[model samples]
Target chain A: MRNLVVLWMLILSMSIMAQMRDFQVITPELTGTLRLGLIRQNESLWLSDYKKIAAKKNGTETIYTIKHEWLNKGSIRISTKPLLDTHGFVMKIETTDIPASIHLFWAFGGCLGEVINLTGDENSLKPEFCKDNVFSIEGNSFTVYYGTSRKLRILEALVPPDSDVRLSDAHQQQTPLSFFNSGKKNDAPALAALTPLKNNEAVYFCFYKQNPKADYNYFMLPELYKKGSYEVHSETQWMKSTPD
Target chain B: MFKPLLIICFALFVGMYIKAATYNVKDFGAKANGKNIDSPAINAAILEAEKNGGGTIYIPAGEYLCYSIRLKSNITIYLESGATIVAAFPGAGKDEGYDAAEPNPDNPYQDFGHSHWQNSLMWAIGEKNITICGSGLIYGKGLTREESRLPGVGNKAIAFKECHNITLRDISMLRCGHFAVIATGVDNLTITNVRVDTNRDGFDIDCCRNVRITDCSINTPWDDAIVLKSSYGLRYFKDTQNVTISGCYVSGFDNGTAYTAQWETDEPQAPDHGFTVGRIKFGTESSGGFKNIAITNCIFERCRGLALEVVDGGHMEDLVISNITMRDIVNAPIFLRLGARQRSPKSTPIGAMRRININNINVYNADSQYSCIISGIPGHCIEDVSFSNINIYFKGGFTEEDGKRVVPENETVYPEPWMFGTIPASGFYVRHARKILFDNVRFHFAEKDKRPLFIFDDVEKSDISNIRVNGIKVENPFTAH
Candidate 1:
């Protein structure tokens, strides 16, 4: 009986591990890097050429910093620092010498499942429509909840905002959002549109996931946190905690 | 370890056997947020599907901001209910507009907008077997309505060039910059159950073949609701053939009120704009000519009437129009102009216009000034035209002085119903036509007008029978010059 029980547990654990992966987002999953527009112009950057990436692990926590620089044209520099826990991570972004509206787009690969809106309302945890403050995704067997420290704007696709497709002045029409490759819908990756970074400024966002088995309680948390201010509870403590 | 390996192998086998996969744009990073530009992610998902032979690219419900979306072969862009693709606002800077129209040497042959496909919010060129279908909305908010000869604005909601086997169904378009849809040199096209409410021209099928437009409701205040053209823009003289437009409803509303349906029940009448335009037409651009066409079962409300023009040195023949109902027509209910604008190359002389038939047409409240005209140039008379079972009501208020007015022969000018000003006749005017026939035709007016029912100027080989004026039989209604 003891041997049978050990074998059963081993199979169950293996299956569970296969079903639910540890919050390890490989390099490709987070393919987006920081971009700095020196002249405040609209141009896409190659993520590999401009990124400086580093990561450190301490106990059960990991810290990552990614900085990018553009030396010529406008001499722009931008950086993203993320503190990752088992559930998810929190990131702080800083930029310098951005002359005009500069955009940074990122994708969390396949980690986030089917997306549902978080209509912050009084009946639920968050009562307001935070531009894009909170959302939910379906996990392997349950719904997982995610919340951001700030109201992040989400985009269905990454198309340059100012591109025009009008060829003639007949009737003098203007098409502002033109496609680079026509007829291929949404060829660019889906990403979040961050608020434009100024010459010297930083914005903070916290991304934390909640298992639906645990009622979504973090909706009541405030947006915008300091560097290293968001702390994740240890596994032993989280396992024993009750609903707030 | 052996068990894990077995499981992995099984998974790989299953993955390999899957015939085609459904790719959600969300998986590729499309945020359905109302304001984000979603064209890139949606395009990426389509390309991914194309890479895998061909699959469905599914778009869930949300407002997706998009620019131009390139379409590939063997793909269907499926939009879930309540999904919308909105045009983004023109931000600062000139390059921020749509990709500049590709410079083609044939551009001088046609207007700037008709010469290229790149200057549209959604466009396909030289593609095959593509479809955009859903019970969704495409709102062209920030697209430009400016008519220009330059390449710096977006003018069309959807444009196609040299494409094949395209289908657009069950979609609604609102405020579609200039033309809601324009297909040039496209073959095997099907557009059904679509609605277009716009301020400018609706659908323009130019130099296309095998087109079927059915069960559509179009309201445009500024221009023609549906038009067929064969312009020299395609560089080659490809005749438009095998077209059937039926079971459709067309009308005009105020400049910006087509989508709101305000013209139906409420809203004060804005006749200054709506009454002047909005009708079905075939060519002001008849360079390549038209053939094998049938238009039937159409209704026109509160707009201009039907017009057929073969002015740009192209043949207009073998056309059959039937079962048309029109109300509140601000101009002549039926106007056919076959002129010698001579928009042909030096080697090509003017072409012929003949063999046209119109039947089962009813018009009410037609404008009083210009009667329905069938006109051709002095020497080149239109040939073999027939009209049957037609009834028209004119807004009678003309005096004897109006009856004596002689319509001019504006041969080379733009072809419009009102281009000749007031005509001498109150009902039908046939000028420079041969072998003309009218049967079971009735003309009436709300008030008494002392004008002839039919005036023929240089007409030849005509037959007129069974005509009525104000419910009374009139004998010899024809007055020939």
Candidate 2:
């Protein structure tokens, strides 16, 4: 009987560990390396200042929730998961309150060599080699290829239907991402200013390191994180948990 | 002189015999009371008429509660001015309801209401040269508006399948169940001066050909007023061709109010929580196609606008819509979509939409959230569409922020304006189209809106001239590659 009990406990622990492998709590160290904030009334509120409350595992993603008392009377949750068959990650930003704007700034140390706008105007496919410039996208989605030293990073961002998108240098202290440190002049971090989200709305962003030899399917990347798979939990679930 | 006199006498005798073939339900023991089920007596009269090689079945002024009134070919059901046929409720005993819904092996493609013909207040199958006329009322008091498989629940007021040369005129329907009239695979059908104040779809003309629907007043707050569909309910693909709907009035008023002219607004929303859906549309179910259709001189009040959708693996071509005026429009004034729902057999290909011409339209108090959308899927572009002499006034409050929103390529989902939330443009949003033209079009907003008048994405060979916004002339506003 003692041996059988030990085997049962071992099996239960192994199953729990297997389930836990699908989720990873985003630590403070990881959040520090990234710049994220909300832009409201032409002011940038950094995510670093938000109080991290709880981290929960939901399906194939890990949800990290953070709240601000005076922002919009609700919390902001960031759910992220790595791509199953690729070397990238998809992150989604969902809010419980309606903000003036939801912004994301991705800093890549130095200025990108070339910016290739895929879904733009007649000037699409024309390479622009600029360090600190902002490009106005006419549509709600921006799919761009950034060239660096011996590597190409592809990023695709999708906002709510009918919203606009902008790709700008992170060094410029704009209303969207001004709270982040204004790096040196050569730092051209991509900033996407999504339109203000309604309560319980979400925006998705994906980043991938392209393989030089293989053909990259640009259109299929967004389908990896389709909106139907992302579940929006009730605000009461997050409100009931005590702040860490 | 004797032979000529004999021939004249014989002709007079035959004429008099032909004139005496009118069968009356009251003579067949129908009481015409409001309580008793009079369908057996009515059916007996119909049988007597049919036995004499078809004649007129006359129903005079009275209220008759009935169950299923089976219809035969070569018969005319004529009702007098005050005649009303009320649908009776199904009873709990065995074999006590309307005729059991006939088993249809092709029931997979369409809804349950479209698949069955026997479970109705009146039904005709494979019949021809049938006419139902006279100013009378058909009040479906006990039919169900919902789709069900229960033993004793009838859904359609009148259903005809595979019938030809059918005419329904000068009749009124009230509180009809799933559909006021559903005609599938019916050809040479004519409906004129028919009024319907119903709970669900007023008319579903499906898989039909050579149809003429004119001078009708239809009010359906919960569903479509007059919709033309080509569903695969007949187990075969057929086109709804040579159709004309002219001089009709469609509205989304409360049930039983349009006939009374009250126009009540107490029920602001439909059961689906969307705005009231009462408009002329084509094909939520289109397995076959639509061709040579023309709609002219239609008035819409307090309802959604004209929608032309070909989602299910079918082709829509050669349509001309003109002389339309709308007030208190709820959604897009004109929505055209060529989607790839592919709700047919696995061998069917995606559908196509082309060669549509619309002109001389005036709309007032339109919703600002959705623009007049004309969208097609990625590879399948809507081809050769033209709009001329159009004027629309929108209730606009869209800011610059609203214009920046994205529109998803809902390739296979149900097509509706609200499927994509707020459109980026205030006036017109055209995407994935080819060879489009706009001339003498004006857009006026009641309030200030910051979005552009037009937004075109992936469109080719577009021609724009004489376009005005708020009385100010504007050039081609914005185009995305």
Candidate 3:
């Protein structure tokens, strides 16, 4: 009975801590060159204001949706839905107005994953290999390793037409997108276009992990991998998906 | 009465210990979603930590969009491996961006960018014993790269001013708007194992003392990768002294692609004439002197060569560079200049540069025409410089006429290799200097050249030993002084 009381007290404290600090979990995994659509409603608008607006937990999967607004001009939305059984996620993008050009720039070392490969949306866009990717780091690989074990692989899914991606350097001096070719890894964070915004014009992109399953824990969420399983396992089961 | 006082003292000591607690930003109403601006919660957590006489603020693996994270002394922000602190873009509302750049009455002396520090994603002013460490990322997504003062644009990733005992380690910055890290008037700084691959300047250690930067990799195509400056940003002649930069690599690659081993392609697009302004430099801003500096065991690739300048009235002394390697150099392999641009106080005179020792440098595929140059102003000559065990390979296609070309004395112009306009010497051009020595140095060219390897003008007390041209011992590889 005394042991049961101790266990109950521990549970009570845990619940209290969770209730006290209910900050939302922002996805740090998606980084580097972001995608923004240029649209014209009244004047010219670029969907540069990107922010995560909502997050929902279903089963072992969490879905995060980001909204992009062009300064009271227009709105666009994107969502990252993690898969319950794989190291992958589905990205759904919705456009409101037509954008002129799309620009993409990959960050040299960021959380988007190592050895990224993109598929989906009919594979209309393909990245080329570049040779100028050389850097030196101490006690780690030159390529940034994400997560605790650093085994996550970021895979791209879709690329819309009228898309152009390039490698740009130098702050304050804008390098034209024509300077670089579409390369993979840090070289190829590509941009795509969603022109002629019409009703119900939604596109899909999937950035899933391939052939990587590791169990680890970090300070922010130490209980994430507490089960020591490579698969997603959570005691707090949530709804997998709800009809819209 | 004594027993009561002792008890009270013990209680107070214990209370102090209890107050120093670990504050998690999430607990203080910080939503880790990449959308919400959580600067207030994070700042509150920091305030709570500060109130407790300094503590650790732990941020877990998640995306946190923040607007300006003001720092405090004696506080350590430990980001879990997957955690990221992202800067928010403008257009949220008015009064949202970083506090506009601090107004400096001494602004005209420097560029508009160098005069301020408050317009940044993360800034600390007049703090001490501060550290921002972890395997986390600082993504300057919404930060602007504009040099001019735009009230709504955030320019820098991390800026520290007038702080001491600063330690920045294991942080990766991407596309930092203007500069990845800018620390001015900071003392006793140790920045190690930091990776910066961005669009602009990497690490600008300005007006600092007792700085040790090691094991850092900076890949910036448009600006100096790692620079040491002594600007009048502090409005004084505080010297940058006792600095050591070792075990570092500076390279120029396409933006967003360095070290991932991806994007490996033939005929890769070169950035700006296949020459990146990526090099290690000292003082484009030299209001204060630089002394007791050493740069060793470093590598430079696909970029401009090493530049050491004292153009703005600042005395530089006791500098040593050794064990350096270079590849795919597009311009001169080395440039040492002592000029009289004199952007310092009117009372300050032209600076003096002396006692520079360079050893064990190897270069491959250097531009043959531009070659290496060490020049001083007409009257103010560089003194007591020596080079040993240096081997350089050039893409030589120069004729005797190219060798006889008289490089102009554009002393006041910005000190750059191309500024001299294709020097005559295929190996080195020494002018307006004294006590110069070259021992065991060889200059190799891909194509045979008619010009002598070295040129000397207005040189005094020159000593050359074991000099070779295309692997053959020449009677005098240096001539036409």
Compose the digit string of candidate 1's lDDT tens values, residues B1-481: 9999999999998886553567788888889897777888888998998898777788889998887777888888887888988876544354454555665665544555677678788888898898888988888876755332233346688999999999999988988876899999999999999999875678999999999999999987657899999887778887788999999988876545666756641221221212346789988877888999999999998888999988878888899999999998888898999886755455655666788899999999988778789999889898999999999988977777777887889997778776787877888889999999999998889877777778889999999988998888888785411
Q: In model 1, which regions exceed 4 Å deviation?
A: A1-244, B1-19, B93-95, B148-152, B264-274, B479-481
Alpha carbon lDDT of residue B38, candidate 1? 85
lDDT of 1 by residue, A1-244 (tens): 1110100111221112111111221121221111211112445443323334344433323333334443223332222223222233333445545446555432221222223332222111111211111111111011111122121122111122222211111111011112121221121211123244554555433333333221111211122123323233232121221110
lDDT of model 3 at residue B231? 85
Tens digits of per-residue lDDT, candidate 3, A95-210, equal: 44424332222122223322343321111122232123222211111112233211222232223322332333312111222213223334432332223334346543333332
TM-score of candidate 3 relative to the true fold: 0.67
DockQ pick, better of 2 and 3: 3
Error of 3 at A68 (Å): 29
What 10-residue stretch in candidate 3 chain B is worst by lDDT?
B263-272
lDDT of 2 by residue, B106-177 (tens): 666677787789899999999988999999999897787743355565778999999999999999999888
Docking quality class, candidate 1? incorrect
Q: Please provide, for model 3 over B55-99, each residue's C-alpha lDDT reduced to its tens digit, 9 standing for 90 to 100.
A: 888888999998888899998888889899988765424566666
The per-residue C-alpha lDDT of model 3 at residue B75 equals 88
Task: Give all candidates' CA lDDT scores.
Answer: 0.63, 0.71, 0.65
